[model samples]
Target: MTGILRLLTARRGAGRLHWTDWATYAYLGLAVLLMFGPVLWLVLSSFKTPAALLEFPPSFLPMTQKEVRVEGYPQPLPLFSVTMEDGSTRELAQVRRVGLIAQMVDPKAPGTTVRVAADKRQPVREMAFAVSNYTEPLAKYDFLRFLENSLFVTLIATAITLVINSMAAYALSIYEFKGKTLAMLAVIGTLMIPITIVLVPVYLVVTEMGLVNSLWAVILPGAATPTGVFLLRQYMLTIPRDLIEAARMDKASEWRIYARIVMPLSAPALAVLTIFSIMWRWNDFLWPLAVLTKSEVQTLQIGLNAFQGELQTQWHYLLAMTVVTLTPVAIVFAFLQRFIATGIANTGMK
Candidate 1:
């Protein structure tokens, strides 16, 4: 790992770079842009005001029109740089707009007004972030409640998924049952079935169980994912059977063996599953949307969806809320990603 980091970050000696090296750097740069450019845009746009968001020629940075207080005006007037007829420019404050013409006043001489073509004037703008875009929604909406619900659902569901999937994987990998092959095949076969097909049946079952409008409605239905089971079972198969035999010879109980021996050794695979489960539960919308109908039970994603109205959508608030929602998932991935490649690459070995 240290060698890999050194190769990645080390400076080159005094030599011309090879064509392949240039090509590799270009590919890496493009890949990084493709992966993170939109995310960076989203974060930056979250800071923009509503008017800035609606601007035709979008800017990379958050900016707002500069305003100045004029003597006669009751409110601050928007400042503009007006181009004069003889190719001169002056800073003026816009009082009003009448079709193609704009009523402007010089900040120094507020008593006099000048009429200029609106096209000839450009609004003075400065880098400004609309923090209210984030603050207003958190204040007006039940943001904390929704965040709590989302956290509860993600954490509980992920825990349940890990426990259930790991146990299933343990059974399938270690035990010598009569129909073990058929059971493994059946587990793998579920992967071919799309979640859409199962939605109605799952909802019906949850309704029958009186879990609708409850967090469990979303959590329980997806607790045992086939992908988790398959990945874990493949990884568990690589564990030496002699370990289990030695534990048995030492009079270790099955539960003790599973808890102490199997689980610790499967940490990398479990970490991989934990990350997958967190992402799945955190970003899940359709299942929760179908299950959680009440405002009290809604997750952050559903709450964010509420910003859309029949006629107009609150893009500014929505973007800000999206950034807030993505933060926890990003943190989880950052911490657990070290085990991902190792878990995946070694799953099929031996």
Candidate 2:
């Protein structure tokens, strides 16, 4: 917390700001606005009504027309600020509208109705949040099941990816053998292949294994990523060779050396890889969509399709669920982000 405060209050070298400081602060301010402005808009819009969302001039605040109940009125009437002929404004409840004129009534005097031009009246609105945008969907859809499926796929797949990639990296970095360079090149080579190119073949293979509509179909195929292997391997190369030799002289097994020494020392790199793996598995859409067809097993990304339809889409609900879906990834990144710079910088060392 003190570190955060220091960063937030940082200035130019314990003295008055220089021109460069002004430029740097301006650039940083713009960058922050560009990054977080849309996210702020999305969170606010998720609380807006359908009509307010469709308005031509979008409002930053969630606003709804104020309504009031008057004596002898069967329903609540929308309140409006009406301009009278004397050029004074009065707060009146709108009873009905005909042509360009609105019949306005004073809530205190229900017997008299005053007709005012629609153009002369503005809606009396207040900041209101439509909580139903979030509530209705949870009540109507099987979000809990979708959440479970997504959590299962993301967690299991990430664990498998880390284990497999770290093992491959350990072998590649620690042992020298025939075709080692070629194997490393081939692993790195897979990064060039666009995911779209392999979707069909991967789907066919998954079908052959009879894992369609299964969470394993999503988890197993992406268990070993070349990127993870390359990152971990490069970082592992920086580990001193003497550490392994000393472990061997101590009668420790290869697995013990890998687990006890290599793994613990490679903490930063592992954290970076873990973050990548979680994001990849959690946000994966097309592959999960192709594999999990059954509603019972569908992940959150696929389940978001429920809000989209042939005729109309529920943007409010979609936006709300999207915020919900982003929460876990944000939390994970927040916790693990400190390792990114350390891991990436050291990976370049021979």
What is the C-alpha local distance difference test score of each model?
Answer: 0.93, 0.92
Whole-structure CA lDDT of model 2: 0.92
Structure candidate 1, residue pairs in collision: none
Candidate 2, 1-350: lDDT as tens digits:
99977766677778887777788878988999999999899999999998889987999888988999999999999999988999999999999999999999999898999989999999999999999988887778888788888899889988899899999999999999999999999999999999999999999999999999999999998899999999999999999999899999999999999999999999999999999998998899999989888999998998899999999999989988898888899899999999999998988733
Over 1-350, each residue of candidate 1 has an lDDT whose tens digit, in order, gives: 89878655544445676666677778878998999999999999999998999998899999899999999789999999999999999999999999999999999999989999999999999999899988999889989889999999999999999999999999999999899999999998999999999899988999999999999888898899998999899989899999999999999999999999999999999999999899899999999999899999999999999999999999999999999999999999999999999898868633
Write down the TM-score for model 2. 0.95
Per-candidate TM-score against the hidden true structure: 0.95, 0.95
lDDT of 2 at 335: 98
User: In model 1, which runs have C-alpha deviations exceeding 4 angstroms?
Assistant: 1-5, 8-14
Clash-forming residue pairs, model 2: none
